[model samples]
Target: MEDPAQRRVDYGDRSFDEADLAACPLEQFQRWYSAAVDSGEPEPNAMTLATAGPDGPSARTVLLKGVDARGFVLYTNQRSRKARAIAHEPRVALLLVWHGTHRQVAVRGRAEVLPRAETEAYFASRPYGSRIGAWASEQSEPIASAAGLHEREAQLRRRFPDTGSPGDVPAPPHWGGYLVRAVEVEFWQGRTSRLHDRLVLLSRDGSPAALDDGAAWRLERRQP
Candidate 1:
């Protein structure tokens, strides 16, 4: 029994200057997000979602479904452990990593369920199998066996035979979306000698209004 390999890799000298920051944090996020995508980063939209309940903290990775003037969007089952935790405590955190580009973003925010119409539109756009999965798997729920899970999938398939036209697959009653309106956001860029660049933006009232208006957020640099 021993520690893992100890190898240190020196980072690049990239910098994130306050002068070049976008008027709104969402705009800045779009720029960095596009960079990650153009660099061919694997699953560039994947994000780590952290939630807390009365018991303790929980974390899981979920794909970034969308982003707009308001905030970051992701879809999940309403009965999920994360959703339950969010109901108990609406505060949550999100982390996005672009290791190949030596960049990362951490966001502390409050999660809110999206409007039903918005969720329906997003759900209708998903692949047919994924739409079926929304109905088949009671996310975060224990099952007796693998066969049992497959059985549920089989039932869903029979209910919706056309896999090409996902629109025909009704959105599950318990599946929808959440918008994380950032209260605070930090962007980190790796630099040489372990010194990194950290820039943070804070919303005045920790609400979407403060997040999107540009003038309501205070921006500052943090020591690495």
Candidate 2:
């Protein structure tokens, strides 16, 4: 049975047209993404990342740190549950919804750990506190209490004293980023009636491409 607290409603924001869509999924994604950000949607870059473990599927909200023709990139603790799952099964799914704009994007792709150089570059850009936090968190592991967690963070702080040293904290061995190269991407937009618009772009050679190579993608519209 459905939960009593669950709610359902029809979308009625705007219509979408295939004629107006970009030939490449990356370009189309950029167009909608820019609009979402410019329109001041809350957490415009937030996305739900889903992975499959031995037991079942798990999902969590993650921030989208970078995106380009190659695919979408996000950082996380390499020891986190999601990372563990991805280690066994590299395929993952991502979803992003913009409530105010009544739009959402879904991505199906395979994930690969970013190169050490890329991870280090991003880690270096992090604020001091965030860099320390990465080292302190044993993500998805049990902790005795909040105090215990704080203690570990304090220990990291002392070891890596933010002495304003030119010595930037290095990216921990257990921390890094992943690039999800999309096999398929779908975009949905709300319409006046219950019949909304759904468009999908699929890769031909099953390889990631940059913005300029977007022409290799095939486009199609799906019935809502």
Most lDDT-accurate candidate: 1
Task: Candidate 1: list runs displaced more than 4 Å.
Answer: 1-5, 206-210
Global Cα lDDT for candidate 2: 0.87
Model 1 TM-score is 0.94
Clashes of 1: 0
lDDT of 2 at 215: 73
- State residue 193's C-alpha deviation in candidate 2, in Å: 3.1
The clash numbers for all candidates, in the given order, read 0, 0
Global lDDT scores for all candidate models? 0.88, 0.87
Q: Pick the TM-score winner.
A: 1
- Model 1: per-residue lDDT, tens digit, 1-224? 54557767777788778887888888888889999999899899999999997778999999999888778899999999999999999999999999888899999988999999999998988888888888999899899999999998998889888757757798988899999988898888899987898999988766645444689788889999
Clashing residue pairs in candidate 1 are none
